[model samples]
Target: MKFLTHTSIAFILLLFASTSYSARIKDIASIQGVRSNQLVGYGLVVGLPGTGEKSSKFTEQAFSTMLRNFGVNIPIGEKLKIKNVAPVAVTAELKAFAKRGQKIDITVSAIGEAKSLRGGELLQTFLKGVDGKIYAIAQGSVVVGGLGAEGADGSKVMINTPTVGRIANGAMVEKEVISPFSQGDTITFNLYESDFTTAKRMADTINNLVGANTATMLDATSVQVLAPRNISQRVSYLSTLENLEFEPARGAAKVIVNSRTGTIVIGQDVKLLPTAITHGGISVTISENKTVDQPNAFAGGKTQVTNNSTITITNEDSRMFTFDTGVSLNDLVRAVNEVGLAPGDLMAILEALKQAGALQGELIII
Candidate 1:
């Protein structure tokens, strides 16, 4: 009996060890009608590092006009000399059912010729939603990720896009977006990704957790759930339903390659078919050297322009390999990596393989 118990424990451990991780419905699906709304507004950023937007007539006009609203009316169309201001568009996300007095992060993007938004303070600006309704007020210092400098002679510098910036907890939610929580007898759930298998699994999970007939899969992207008639018990139902565990269907394996970065990511379950592959890299360089030859001691005429240029072209090719299809992803990755080709080269090879139907996995270039 002890031996049988030990065998069962070993089998259970083995099963656990072989289980693969899958995205859960709780992690991928949101409760029906629960989402954040996008809010955007045009505002200004003050105190920049002289990289602010070029003095546009409209920029100065707006600045002067705004100042006039504060009882200091500067004449419109006057030449306003401003050096420390940058016109920016402020944007923020208004979470679903966000209540008043809640703080949210805001992003400030430069609209003018501002070199960098660094060390800039954004004044209190009202954020409006697409419906043209003011929902929140934002005020904070902008944080840019770029810098610049000048030198007497031509100087080299780095470009990190100093125009865009972000402000953490910069906006305050003043108005709540009206989302009816109790509008009907049923509530719908939306999956983050459209997966038929996941949708069905989620519906089954919910039904099993609540009752036999409470949830039904509507389609690959949505699930309709019949809420409990007792509103008081609905919250409890949802709480337990999200925690239910079940294995998700294994998705198709894929390979994502970034040609520019020479990056290759192999998804689980990637399979390769038998194929012959060969790749080569060729580099060409052309350089020109200028020389000046002057006639000395009345030797000849004036100096003539002399130019020397050289062009070099070189190429290295890899031997063709007949690969076996149906190889596991790890083996395939190891074999390909052993070829010593760069990521960019691998990307081209993957594209060719995919076109030839030699690779069974989906190849996504990003």
Candidate 2:
């Protein structure tokens, strides 16, 4: 028998158990025109301890601009050795319906060659949206989650990410993103995952709770519901509609295989066709022995060194398992477990079964 070696088996089986739970409309879908906007800005980080960028042209230009704004101008082409400042990019999400003076968290990332952003403070920066409008202003002390230390001999030790930092409530919203929630007499709910069955069920549930012809299924992902024209009444109607619960359609059967980590995720709806599987393993071992052969003390003969190597191969007897038609997921799992096959072996077995049309589900390998 051919020998197969250098095989390491590690199994992480994720079996999703089937459960019946009614989910609320709000948990499964989101109202149209209710979303956050991304805002980004270029800024500077100051007060670093010799870890900032030393020779970045953009950093120097930004520093010069800021100084000129304060009525302090340096001679043209004069190099300033400001090692405590680093150019950075600031970003934040402006939440929907955010009012003026509202505070939001901001993320600061080094855009220059800064070694670390620890002990740095972000200067005032205006964050702009996709439309080139300033939506928020950010300025605060950065809180880095990582730490680093360096010695004189270029030895360095670091933990986590020392270049990125965050600030809680670092940005103040100066403008609000307009939403169309209050303008339309009918509101549309878009499901996170588009499914025709799910959309129909949601529409039916809403119509039954509110009234007949109150909800309409627009497509596989959106459902429109009629609401009162009055703003106060519309709010109350939405509150009632979001809290109503209904069972969602079962997801499609799928098996996710991670080739790198030896992980297999089996869906609850997976079924097996009638088939027989045989699993076996072959192991190879090599042994080496070294010995020195010396002549008798008075013979004066040269000594010799000898090396002996032994190779052994063993193959386990293959075991067969049979599955009847319409085998459920639980039964398939129990049968596979009884075989006591390693993860690598099981992975190969699943691939073979998929190819042979015995597995009644999609097999996705990552």
Error of 2 at 221 (Å): 1.3
Local accuracy of candidate 2 as per-residue lDDT tens digits, 1-366: 011111211112223237677999999999998899999999999999988988878788999999999999989989987689989899999888899999999999988788899999999999999999999999999999988888999999999888899999999999888889888789999999899999999999988887898889999999999988898998898999999899888888888888898777777778889999988868899999999999999998999999999999999888999999988776777766667666677789889989999898999999
Give the Cα-based TM-score of candidate 2 against the true structure.
0.88
Per-residue lDDT tens digits for candidate 1, residues 1-366, read: 333343344334544534665555677778877779999988878776666777687678768767877889776556776678888899999998799999999999988777678899998899999899999999999887877675769784756877788999999999998775556788787877788987888788777767887888888888888876565687776677666676666666777776675556666667678887777768999999999988886786798779999999988765566677587664655555456555566677888888888788888887
Cα-based RMSD of candidate 1: 10.2
The best candidate by TM-score is: 2
Clash number for each model: 7, 0
Regions of model 1 farther than 4 Å from truth? 1-19, 47-54, 152-161, 229-232, 272-325, 334-356
Residue pairs in collision within model 1: 51-114, 51-115, 52-114, 53-113, 53-114, 273-325, 274-325
- TM-score to true structure, per model: 0.73, 0.88
Please state every model's RMSD to the true fold in angstroms. 10.2, 5.4
